[model samples]
Structures are given as C-alpha cells and as structure tokens.
Target: MTDAILRVTGLHKSFGDHHVLKGIDFSVAAAERVAIIGGSGSGKSTFLRCLNFMELPSLGTVALDGREIGRPAGGDGARYYPEAELCAVRERVGMVFQQFNLFPHMTVLDNVMEGLVTVKGMKRAAARERAAAELEKVGLGAKFDAYPGRLSGGQQQRVAIARALAMEPEILLFDEPTSSLDPELVGEVLRVIRQLADEGRTMLLVTHELGFAYHFATKVIFLADGVFHEVGTPDEVLKQPRQERTRAFLARYTEFGF
Candidate 1:
C-alpha cells in the first residue's frame, strides 16, 4: 500500500470539442496540504471537482485511500462505482466549494446536522452534538440558531466548513474557498483553514491567495492548460519556479507586488 491518500492519473476533461484538463496526474499524501494555483480558465476548479466526481472526467483514474473510485465499464467510457460505493467515497472525501452552498431555510446547526442525520443515519441528538462541536471548531458555535442570511459571508462559509467537518472525512478538497468572500472577510476564512492546516488535516486547496498558499501548503502545484506546469514545495514552486511558463505567470503577480 502506498502512502498516498489520493491519487489521480491521466485525468482528462472536455466540454464538447474544447478540452479543459489534458491528461493530468497527481497525488496527495496523508496530512499533506497541497495548493493548486493557476489563472482563470486554467482548469483548476475542474481538476478539483473531478477528484470528488462532481464533474466526471472524460478519461482517467481517481483513487482514494488505495481504492479506485470510478472504473472503466467498457470501451473508453468510465463506469462510476455504484451509488453505495460513491456515497462512501464522498463521505470520506469532503469538499468545500467556492460558494457557501448552505441551506437557507435551515439554521446553522440544522444545516450542519442534516448530513449526519440523513446520510449517516445519525440520531438527531448525537448529530446535534457533533454539529455543535464542528461549528465550535470553526468558531461559529454561538451562531447555531442563526439562519444563513443572518450571518456574514465569512460566517456562512465557516458553517459550510463545519458541515463538511461533521462527517469526519479522511481528506478535504477546497475549491477556491475564499474567492467569493469580501476582501475584509477573506482573512477570517483563511484563518479557519490555516488552523486546519496546522492541525495536520489532509487538504487539497485550489486558491488564488498566493500568500496564503505559500504559508499554508506543504506542496504547491502550478497548473496551466490542464497540465501541471510545476510541482514542488511552496518555496520551490512559488518562489524559484524553473519552468518558463511558471516563471512568467509568477512574474505577473510579482510585478503587482504580490
């Protein structure tokens, strides 16, 4: 058995004739924080989505904890695991989207508890306890009864994070988690993520915050045109990139004093 917690090989995705991700391959080790960075239209989000099977790949293999997720049915098409297996995979691989994607009608606590109760079949009382603990982890315990509308963008996002955490997933995938927040609120959300990173939680984050990625990621991958242009430690990839494309891209950020 390999030490990799997640492994993706020959990943490819296309929208009709327009290909987005082109034969990508990568892996994440246990407790490793990997940050995927790239400009718009670079397939960063699509790559992250493919990991959890949110967007099915046109081709490739994705394995979590040594088990291959979707398998090839016949011909060139891929056959995803049955619903039961998929559900189990999803439960183990938690995802936090760019948007909060919370239920507006439910209170923060209910929103967090819903998955535990529904998917995990957890008792309401036990789910409530777990939900509250997760919310407290994100520093939102006091807002349990508050509706999403009553919370600030950062708070709502934290609720979403808590909801994912309540599942006790083995790995977390963050897709530009701070992109939609107001600049003032971005710091709060980043702090919560930073805390998770400090706790050695395995995470794969797609982010635009170069500084945060540099500080939080144990490894950094630079994606371009659906391929990994550079992959290395934060300092190696972000600061001393050897690839021309990677250097040019980082130069733009540096020019603006990022």
Candidate 2:
C-alpha cells in the first residue's frame, strides 16, 4: 500500500521577532509530486529547509516514513535529534538549492559522487557508477568531466540534480529549481523534473513557474504571510484558488491586453 512519505505537523519557525513559518502542516504521499508557490518572503524556502532540519523549527514535528525525524522523544519530554542522528535524517531527504550550489573546485562527476562516497558510505567505484547514471538521467552524461565554471547555468543545475539523485533519496526537495536560469534554459530543467515525476519520484518544489506548477504537480499549495493559505489539487488551487491572497499573487503574473 502507498503511504505518506513525509509529514509536517504544527510547524512553527521564527527568527527572533520574525515568524518565518506559522503552524505549517503538510504531507506527501509516496512518489507524489507537490508544488508550493507564493510571493517573496512567503516562507516557501524556509519550509523546504525545515524538511531536512537545515533550519530548525521553533515548534513542530517532521516525520519521515513513520519516524519522527529531527525531533526525538525522551522519558521526560521531546527534543530535537542529536547532531549525529540529524545527519542521518538529512541524507534521506536531498535538496537542490535555487542557486545550483555545486562545488566550483570539482568536476561535475566528482560533485555528484562526493555525497555518495562521503555521506552514504558507498565505495568510490560504485559511487562513480551511480553518479554517471544520474548525470545521464539529467541529460548531462557528456558533461561529466566539465567543471561548474565551464557549463551553462542550466547544465550546472542539472549536475546539482544528479548529485542529489545519486544519494537515492526517498524524497527530493527543490527550492526554485529553475529560478536562476535564463528564460531559454528554464525548459531544460523543468523537463528533467517532469521526467522525474514520470518515474514516480516523490518531490516537493517551490517555484514561480505557474504553468509548470499547474501541469506538473499532483498537489498545489499556496503560502501567504508564512501560512498555507490554500492546498488542493492543481485544478483547484491553480485554476480556482479560493483565497483572496492566492488570487492576488496570480494576478501579479497575469498578462492582459491593454
């Protein structure tokens, strides 16, 4: 039976006086693709970061495969995971950042293989093989030996995707995966993501690509003022959002004849 692969409950994150996320709650079924959209500072990125404990939540719980990750239970009370356990939880949820944070000093192949060998404990030979296959999947097989500086923004981002996939994560979190690419380059990255969804990889995406968000997502979430203002199927959320904030956000991107 299919199950919920990731669950966020009562998530509240704050940075001093600024509340970045306010009681956020969502769940991802196995192999389902979900997209999050909102205006700037709406806390989409912060929500993604909380998944892997990159940013600790002030209060809430994140569960993966039925296990409450990041947070731990003790005899007296509950606490976040220790650093070592937190590291293990992070490996299961791989993330690709908006800026394509690939190592400039490493070739594409090494960048992809680094996590496998270092974090996942795969042998170098085996990691290289996995990295190669991932690169090929992202249409970067020919660019394996190319350095980050030598490839286009789209190519570099593809390498970053490959690097995340090489870990064989159960869930992939993407923060504005194509936001930094040129207009012409956006299609390539989005196409790769479409292929991933076709293959049934669970994914959570935060993006401004409304067209892709509507077409590619099984579920759509609209965040506003650090809260999920709406959540529903693509047709419901994108085509007919019930909230005024969501309608307003979409209006800003609408093109109309003068």
Candidate 3:
C-alpha cells in the first residue's frame, strides 16, 4: 500500500472454454512479500505467469514501476507486447518455477551464468563472477562445478534461485518453489527464500505452505475461483479470516496439520 510497484487491473485469462483468472485487481509495493495461497486449480500459477507476461492475459493491464507492460495490439481491446518488450519486462520481473529448471548439461555455475551472458550480454568472465556470488548467497558456492543431475533436489532448487538472483531483478516471482522437492529438502529451499525476504527483495509467491506463508508474507491473498477472496496482513487473512470460503480453505490445511 505504500506505493504499488506492480499493479494489475481487470486481469483475466482463458484457455479456450476454461477461464482461470477473472478480474483480479491487485498490487504490490516495493520490498513487499505477497503470498498467494489457494486450492489447486485456483489460477495461482496462471496469475503469477501473467505478471511476467509469460502467459498473456486475455484481458488486463499489468503495470510495473507505474508503466503498463502490454499494449492494445488488436480488436476487442485485446492486448499483447512484442517479444522484445516482454523480454525487457522479464529482466525486471524474474520468476522461479515449481520444478528446478536447470540445464542438466551445464555446471551449476554455468547454469546460473547462462542467462547473464546470453540474455544480458555480459562477458563470460563477469557473468561467472556474478553467478558465483549469487550461488554463494544461496549456500551453493562449493558446488560450482557440479552438474544438476549430481545435486540434491534442494541444491538444484537453490541453483535455480541463484540463477534468478544473478539477474538482479527488481521483483521476483516464485510459483510453488518447493513443491517438487522431497519433504526433507523443502526447509533448505525455504530458508534460502526467507533469507531473500530478510534482505528486502520484493517477491510474490504462490504456495501451499501455510505455516511459512504465515511468517513470510507481508500481505496474504487467498485467491479462489480466479478472484481474490481475502486480502490483508498475514494474521488477518491466515489466522483470522472473515470470509467463510477462506475459513474452509484454512480448515482443510489445518486438517493436514499445515
């Protein structure tokens, strides 16, 4: 609320006959960590994807730093941006996915450096230095030369995080960042994310980790049926929700001891 760094208005997404997101109006302030929680098929991932222009919204306006990203390119108020513009948007808004998206053939350091060198056009030596520093921050400095296949799930995910951080993005998006990791490995990844939050990185995360969400988020949004069903501070939304739908969702998570 201090001054929205990212804003979405009238957001909507559809895949043929299936409509996922419906008129979601939301915003995030600088250095604010926003946690989005909901049941499966709640459009959490699509909502995150739309922010980075990874999935073009059927109708909406996504603005970053007060500048709207896509333009009206066709009829019916349909909008989209060119790849060049979307690429520019992504440089400022980085995203990490559920699965560890690493290059199996590249060394850990190289995997982190690849985007810097290829996308940002930095020199290989400079990119290597930057990537190594990011890996060190994520507790993976010793595994610089190791390949993705040789690393544990947590380590691979840390590498993924390091890759995203090496870009020095203004905002980060995490979509179920630890969902694919072994139960034991989830903590390691979450710890790294917590460190990022403590360092004051602006982030929006889609997660089912309710307990962590309770502590990690500055603002929590319970998204259901493609709309924001509840939005407030963590305690307001997670610990004391007024909406019955939000209560039922939390009850289900509580049933699982979340």
Backbone-clash count (model 1): 0
Q: Score candidate 2 by TM-score against the native.
A: 0.94
lDDT of 3 at 196: 97
* All candidates: TM-score: 0.96, 0.94, 0.97
| Tens digit per residue, CA lDDT, model 2, 93-189 | 8999999999999999999999998898899999999999999999988988889999999998889999999888889999999999999999999
Candidate 3 on 124-161: residue-level lDDT in tens? Answer: 99999999899999999899999999999999999999
**In candidate 3, how many Å is residue 195 off?**
0.4
Q: What is the lDDT of residue 121 in candidate 1?
A: 99
Best-matching candidate per lDDT: 3
Q: Tell me the spans in candidate 3 whose CA falls farther than 4 Å from its real position.
A: 256-258
Instruction: After superposing candidate 2 on the true structure, give the runs of residues whose Cα lies further than 4 Å from its correct spot.
Output: 71-78, 256-258
Which digits, one per residue and each the tens of the lDDT, describe model 1 over residues 1-258? 279988988999999998999999888888999999999999999999988888888888888877788667888755656777778888999999899899999999999999999999999999999999999999997999999999999999999999999999989999999999999999999999999998899999999999999999999999999899899999999988999999988888879673
TM-score between model 3 and native: 0.97
The Cα local distance difference test for each model comes to 0.91, 0.89, 0.93
Q: Give lDDT: candidate 2, residue 180.
A: 92
For model 1 the local lDDT of residue 147 reads 95
Q: Lowest-lDDT window of 10 residues in candidate 1? A: 76-85
